[model samples]
Target chain A: MTSLTLNAIVSQMAAIEQFTNNILKILEQDARTTPAQIAVMTGRTEQEVKDQIAALEQKGIIKRYKTVIDWAKAGRERTYAFIDVKVTPSRGVGFDDVAERIYKYPEVQSVYLVSGEYDLRVVVAGTSLKEVSFFVSEKLATIDNVQATITHFVLKRYKEDFEIFEDTSEDRRLSVAP
Target chain B: MKPISHIAKTVPASGIRKFFDIVSQMDDVISLGVGEPDFVTPWRIREACIYSLEKGYTNYTSNYGLLELRKHISTYLNERWGLHYNPENQILVTVGVSEGLDLAMRAILNPGEEVLIPEPSYVSYKPCVLFAGGVPVPLGTTPESGFKVTPEQIAAAVTPRTKALLISYPSNPTGATISREELQAIVDVAREHDLFIISDEIYDRLTYEGHHTAVPELNGAYERTILLNGFSKAYAMTGWRIAYAASTPDVIEAMMKIHQYTMLCAPIMSQMAAIEAIKNCGRECDEMAEEYNRRRRLIVAGLNNIGLDCTIPGGAFYAFPSIKKTGLTSEEFSERLLFEEKVAVVPGNAFGECGEGYIRCSYATGIDQIKIALERMERFVENLGVEGRLKAAGRE
Candidate 1:
């Protein structure tokens, strides 16, 4: 293809990418935004919005719509802890194998291969502190190539997943203004 | 008993006074009538005020307001829209845009002179003019032009006694924003008529569709324009009561003379907090505008779908929808909607008589609340249709 045509195609792709980014941002803010609503908000047709969202889902970029809940407020308490792990690299695979093994347990909520002294950070949840400690000492520490671990229990959560947990804000504005 | 001053007694109360009494007594009313933002003042700005109190900076500053706050306002205006106003003599911070409007009117108007204002505008414009001992001439703008007043209409309204033209773009009831080119045409008419332009741009930052054109930025407008703006709508600082007016030195002096003698100055804490707002809260302002835009689209679309025949408002949070098809006056429609559906919207006539046959629905509430309001409105319209048919049958 000529360079001029290639440039045109590249710019067109960039525009589409920008449009997709905008749609993703809206959905991230409120997943319940329907195709028709998104269409009006983004100045696109409903069919076009539906098609883009479907494509995003197929690409795994649009993940599951999960609720951010305050379990303690809802009368369900779970002990949550963040575990820092140091691992000996297995030459080629390094910390990837150890991180995978640690994350495979059902109690592990999430695992990240992080920098600093610890090679991995693992988040775990259980019904009690003892239950969570047992998961870390018995299950996580036993993983291959794991050298040492440090665990910190979360006492209180002020905010989580971009939502303030203890929201006391009210609509104190006047009912009507000039 | 001796009567009160004639002007003070005769100046009309807000048209929403009756609705306020009823709405205050009712429970579970989802109100879309509020003109201010639903957001709390950003905590950082509030904290700045607390810090000022702790440091004992509570005494009144200059009559023109704090020099620091004025400098920041000057810099902010220049940076945002390239409009220049010297902080020392050209900017006078007032108690709110409310005070700024009063001061602008009092400073500029002579007794019996006329101020031509577009109809269906903010509630205070006419009252302020009257208090300034001026006649307010209303130039009606229809929904066919998206509630925007044309230069031709303005020219026609201009008379020898027309001393000033007052306008608020991204207006209160209709949410109409003027494009820069369109505004220039209006400015041209003002210049041709040699009329002072009092531009109340309190809703400038809340503009959704396009960038707001500061009136002073227009060619030859700076020398003739009295620009009024405030921190209320944009920074969620309505309660703070901090706003400013920028104009020529002579005009500012005139306004400051009135302000110093009557109002003295805006509160020190509000001025301090306003400085922090201008310095650090641009991002928060943008985020609020984006959210308003999203809600604006949803509410406008929902209003149209529910048979309200609303034009898309370009700025601010209001959606002015026509209720003519329902065979009810604006007041009747608003009253019935509030009583039956538990949804509160301002009757359009509250803004002006030209606003009759329409209702202003504010989309400043939550998305869920908007969705519920739309459903209620839809149900109400369907019931009205059935009731209309029944009434016709009874007549036959």
Candidate 2:
């Protein structure tokens, strides 16, 4: 009997989910940070950082280079939300087929499959919760495979991977409990 | 990426949203697609909001909302609309008519419950119903029965799991309202089935024919009905986001718990403005309604003149006309009219399946703009070249 090592099983799973988001963990961050700096942070070779980015790019995972705007400065300073959705596939269709149909909606910034009663989740932005609910129901729930949905509005986001690029170097104080 | 959550993955996109996005991209589009008041917030209401801000009253109130706002809502409903509610216990001020609809469903629905939703309704009802973990079983209505929810249709749609029957009069998309007599029949069916009623009366004050009746005021309904009304339509305060739900304490209490966890309360200023709206500006609200009625007549009469026979609406600011004679789908005709004629009316299908071969044209605009829209629509009709284009002329 052949035995698969733990690392081998993990690598196999990671390979499939690699498209979910590249594990560009510990990417160069310091404005003074570069491929050379990341190499120093992770104790990898300077050339290795460049090679990993190139590999990720070749695999079509690194889609584009983008800039982050401060949300307050961007005139979108209001509360942001994420709506968790569950769709009933139209016409006896399965989740994949129905999701494929709905994810194509313009208001949907992101889409995912979730655990529990609902099979899918969506991220959307709107001026207000009423606007968000309007989008989910009037827009998303009307689609096939959206049998039902439960929306968990973000109360406050303590962590956001793409934004809040602070390293916790400063003494951060909160008057109210986060 | 495992995507984000269950909700993001499952629900489909909204048709109205998709249409708005498309329309937003087009040049020279005059959209009657949006179902909101065109008038700005009345001066008295705006002054009231300013007064609240000047007084520096800008903190979150009780989860149910400011006590005075609720008291005003309670009194306003009773004094004007003939409905009764307890300020402290039976009312939950909400984000808008939109949130009140959601709160009603959230409070009522158990998982897998079915909501008997009437078709050609305001776009939000079905989705709001579904979001509360209820299934929306759409009961189709038509011009034949004045587009009101027929008692027979309600009986056919109800099942054991049917938790609520949603009733929206002076309905959006369809522009229909039920008579007091007609409502009594449906009320009988709802009582027999032990079903709850979620009556939406946002357009209650805009009626052209007669005064709107409050179902909750009817015999035995005050206990079961969750009546949702708002100042948006009446006061032209779309952005104010103040609406309230009047119901039994159990329902309002359940809604308040959810409202506290979620919304907290409606904007402090909006509630304050609403207090003045109910207290001071009754005539100002009616002036906007009267203007809409004028444009309603202009559009409906013009459409009839040009061969689109419409069910002249009794309340609300819309005219629903049949487009069958045009030989184009509601989507196609509206799209063509947008580009070629520079007029935008929402497709009937934007409302529901039964909304096919019809269109909802809001008269929420000036008479001059209504005139321009009508003339351009007449040209579009003449050019459709459908065999029955002239058939509509006879129906008029």
What candidate 2 keeps of the native contacts, as a fraction, is 0.00
- DockQ of model 2, rounded to 2 decimals: 0.01
DockQ of 1: 0.58
Highest DockQ model number: 1
Encode model 1's per-residue lDDT on A17-41: one tens digit a residue. Answer: 8568768878887898899888887
Which window of ten consecutive residues has the lowest lDDT sum in model 1 chain B? B286-295
Best model number under TM-score: 1
Model 1 residue runs over 4 Å out of place are: A1-22, A58-60, A73-75, A88-93, A115-117
Model 2 per-residue lDDT tens digits across residues B265-361: 8989888999999888888886667556645755776888889889868888888999997778988887788878877778888778999999888
Query: What's the lDDT for all of these models?
Result: 0.91, 0.76
TM-score of chain A of 1: 0.85
Candidate 1, position B315, lDDT:
90
